[model samples]
Target: MQSAQCSGRTLRFGFFEVDLRASELRKHGIRIKVQEQPFHILTLLLERSGDIVTREELRQKLWPAHTFVDFDRSLNKAMTKLRAALADSPESPRYIETLHRRGYRFLAPITPIREDPAESHANFNHAALERAAASLENDQSQDHPKTGFLLSHPRPPATWTWFSLLLGTSTVLVCLTALFLLRVNHSIALGSSFGNLNPRRSVAVLGFRNLSGDSQEAWLSTALSDWLTTELSAGEQLRTIPSESVARMKIELSLPNVDSLGAASLSRIRKNLGTDLVVVGSYAILGEQSHGQIRLDLQLQDTQSGETVDAISETGTESRLFDLVSRAGEHLRDKLGIRAVTREEAAALAVALPSNTEAARLYSEGLAKLRVFDALAAHDLLLKSVAKESNYALSHAALATAWGQLGYDENAKAEAKKAFDLSANLSRAERLLVEGRYRETAREWGKAIEIYRALSEFFPD
Candidate 1:
């Protein structure tokens, strides 16, 4: 906890000063355009400067009991908005620094004005709040085109890294495929307003219950959650607890599935993980006579209230698992009103599915293993992927990262070069990732960081 006794309920960091009572975030005496969620997030961060504020702490304090929200996504979006207001970067965060899968910390020196809570609110400066609200509304009303959601799709979104039907085009085509891989956090059913889920609630996707009674299918629990989290990774639509974080928790509890979670368990989850949305579901084999058919019962609930904000059920066979999951992912994306580049549009842009699903699967698993620090496994998988499909640029690029992790500088550089050579047809988003890798492998730290900064800004997936 930060002391407010030094200043009078006003906190200053860098060029920005946040009057806690006024709920106004201003730079150089002018208010910045920030919504309530972003402003509140900044205020909370300022209240705990220098110390790390866990994602759970933010949810506990700011989100009310019964506040249905997407805490992680909201926090990320708010942080992004705050950074934009402060002219900061994640590559080199100036004020708020992410602690990877842990949480965030305020990096700048903060000047706090301590004052009586009653006194501060007595002089709340409603005028400033009004000004901020007005600025936000004005910005929203302006002609700035946001890629809003489309409601017509039927397929659930699959994890971009995993299930998008890959196309074996040129290296450029491979890069383009990577661009279409929008990360998903979690899925929620859409209502009339498309604003039902608490936009700023931090969330966790617990393992879906495997009622199939077959231990072989146990991997579905974590894998499905991981996929949903990846699907929701576009921009800042939802804050998803990383699989590694969730895995750590699972290791501690040894709880089999989310269906077995009790109120006490739920409370522990909320406290330990700091989640706002509890995505818990169950899956069962469709019929004893059926070989591969299964059904998923999924729902997004308000952690504090234990209320189901949204829910959906989908059925498919093992052969169509990818399609089923992708449909669910797409439904969640649509509910959130985020626009995705359609398959037709992508095809029109000359993007085709990779020729080998197995290669694509290897690439996906390699990336996953790499995320969990199992670089050796990732390296092996990446190698196999490229060997299976020699034209798989993503596999090569990922292999470069795995090699770098294992201290194989020469191998890393060679793989990176191969990726770059194959990237002539990459979209802006794809080019940003490959170019940054190219620069980094060449030891151009300045260029790599600069490109990464731009990539973070332009393509935040």
Candidate 2:
């Protein structure tokens, strides 16, 4: 039996006819599988031909007042199956169009072979058209009085005027639609190339959640995210938030489960960190690390819009963790439309890196805290790190920055000098940062600005 909503109607469009009275679909003269859910979705799509049906709308329509775990995944599966049955390709659809991160659109023009007089086609702008139709009916009433006739006196005009007005309005609408499509296309073209990344956008990479049952892997979560931050910072175009700032905010806000933070929490954290984007992800070590694979899932959320702009997932072996981090950073930059930076050796550390993982971790934490203006904690941590390893140049440089921020000019200069003298083997970026701090303390504005400018140009992130 056919559904009562579309009862006694045969809607025909393209090569198909949907006979609502019999609940049957025909291509030429054959019948095919039209499952309950897919059939209903098909009708909904047919109703709103040429307009996007958002995932939220579809969820409400399909699963309203029902319990369904992972509705998004289910919807995607349904769409795939529906497309397969229809012989439609999402990439080059003959009937349906898939809009990324949004919803689906029915592409075919709908035509009713016979009208039920009871059911109206649900479609894009249907309500607007209904309202327009009612307005037209009212204007056609003989009892109505015209207020804005655009004439000094009442006079009869030829039917040509009405035709001309209708034609002009249609032409305007078409032009506007064309302009909108052009803009969308241009945006698609400029977005997410293989190389370009958004240079000015500040990104904060939060700790990736470890779904593996082993508590020992907790440090790996922090370590991997640190590596990701480092990889992204290498591009110069990406300004990755220091891990210290992220940890500070995470502690203060009591956001222990940063992985599951909603948009509100993410936005608050981003605002506190003064970053444009917040990158969060979860990871799982499938089976034993010695035998299985490590999987990473990442999301790039736009702080201003609170919308997830990009999502990337990778699976690989533990030994190639660095490779995954590098690829993640590259994809992140590409998503932001930033030009692949030809970063000079500025990103390398000027000093010999600390060999002790704990010391290195402390340095990273202290530097990140200093980035967020928490000089006291940074100073304490840096002091501890240097006590453990006296020749750690990066730690000393960060300590110097802390001293400068705290108005200890002489102390800052001393630390800066020590850092620079010890930085012969350090990365150029670290050396320049330390040099810039000392120049500022010396009140050499011109020299300081010059160094700062060079750093900015060479190491944008």
Candidate 3:
């Protein structure tokens, strides 16, 4: 039957209709296959609608009071299945809002179709219309002050005014709806050419190739990658895989050491790291270390297509290496088609980056050493990095890792706390990492796990 034929018993929300008497759920007049248990749970949530449906209530309704089962697990599994069928996400729920351990509430606004065709036809904003009509009648009585005159006169000016007001309101609503649809269509046309799009794009910055031919400055390879990754993480639409995670994965996969990655390598990185884009780059530092020129080249590779989607390049003085990194990061972000940060955010980001090239170089090398399990070298390098720029938040965070690796619990906790304190200007991902590290040091496993889970949701690599 057509959705229009659904009686007053039928509940409608969005494109879905629930016919309780028929024990059926239909979306756009097509029946959806929902299991018995999940359907019952859905029904309960729907009946309660705006109110919370507690777990205890659900359990009592689903099973007898005397019955025994793994209630929590069963409820969770049912919810998962129901959400899968609805194509809903627990994190950003559309229809069902989870109340953690308490209960669930249906989020969508529901309308019950009237049994009479005339009433059903007028159901659109019926409540508003009723209120308007009642208010109009009261005003008409107050103005005329003659019930007998109103009864005799079958027509009142207030009646015409109410109709005019309703008509104007409906016209405005129609125009707004049309404009909204036009904007939606325009957005869809401009969204993508390939038609394969994700709400958030995940990217990984592989260790840059050091073409400087300077063994002492080899740290630039990992340093540049980490710096770029951190910079990209500042974007709301981009999820960046941590440089340490990418390095560890590279070692685990036994990937070849090369300047550029092949298709197979890109595919493997995508599969293991869950990254949509891989940034591969090379840098060169010419002339002398103090008065040298640095040229950085970067490529944004689409993992699925194994193609270099875009290339970025920047040149600057070697002494202002961190400035070059920042410029390169901005270039790469533009190439990715991500929105630029606001003025305030840009200022905060500037503060988050290392103030001096020396501190950045030391921190990068320290982070690289720490990833390789050389806690002693990492500790020395990171200590000197902080000594050079004590307010560098990332340096303090890396130092905490070094201390933790060396089994200095007190020192690790102190460093983690310091990092957290300094993370106000850091990127969202960096701030979360600092908070998680601090929680771990404080032995707050639950809070640490929650923070890590949130980070995983944001980055997912």
The number of the candidate with the highest lDDT is 3
> Which residue ranges in model 3 land beyond 4 Å of their true spot?
1-199, 453-461
Candidate no. 3 TM-score: 0.54
Q: Model 1 — TM-score against the truth?
A: 0.45
* lDDT per residue as tens, model 1, 166-219: 533356687766665532222222333244435453668776987877775655
Candidates by TM-score, descending order:
3, 1, 2
Candidate ranking (lDDT, best to worst): 3, 2, 1
Candidate 1 weakest lDDT stretch, 10 residues: 182-191
lDDT of 3 by residue, 1-461 (tens): 23333345778888788877877887877887888898899888877777889988999999887788888657766776676556554445688887756888889887886565567667756988999989878877876667523334455599898999999999999999999999999778756532544558888888777786778878788767876776776756687787777876775565533456779889999998989998887888866753678788888898998998888888887566657777877877788787776677667668777878788888878877766555667788999999999998888888997776554678989999999999987877778989998999899999999999997666543
State TM-scores per candidate: 0.45, 0.42, 0.54
Tell me how many clashing residue pairs each candidate has.
Answer: 48, 12, 0
Model 1, C-alpha of 300: deviation from truth (Å): 1.5
lDDT of 2 at 376: 57
Q: After superposition, how far is residue 456 of candidate 1 from its true place, in Å?
A: 4.1
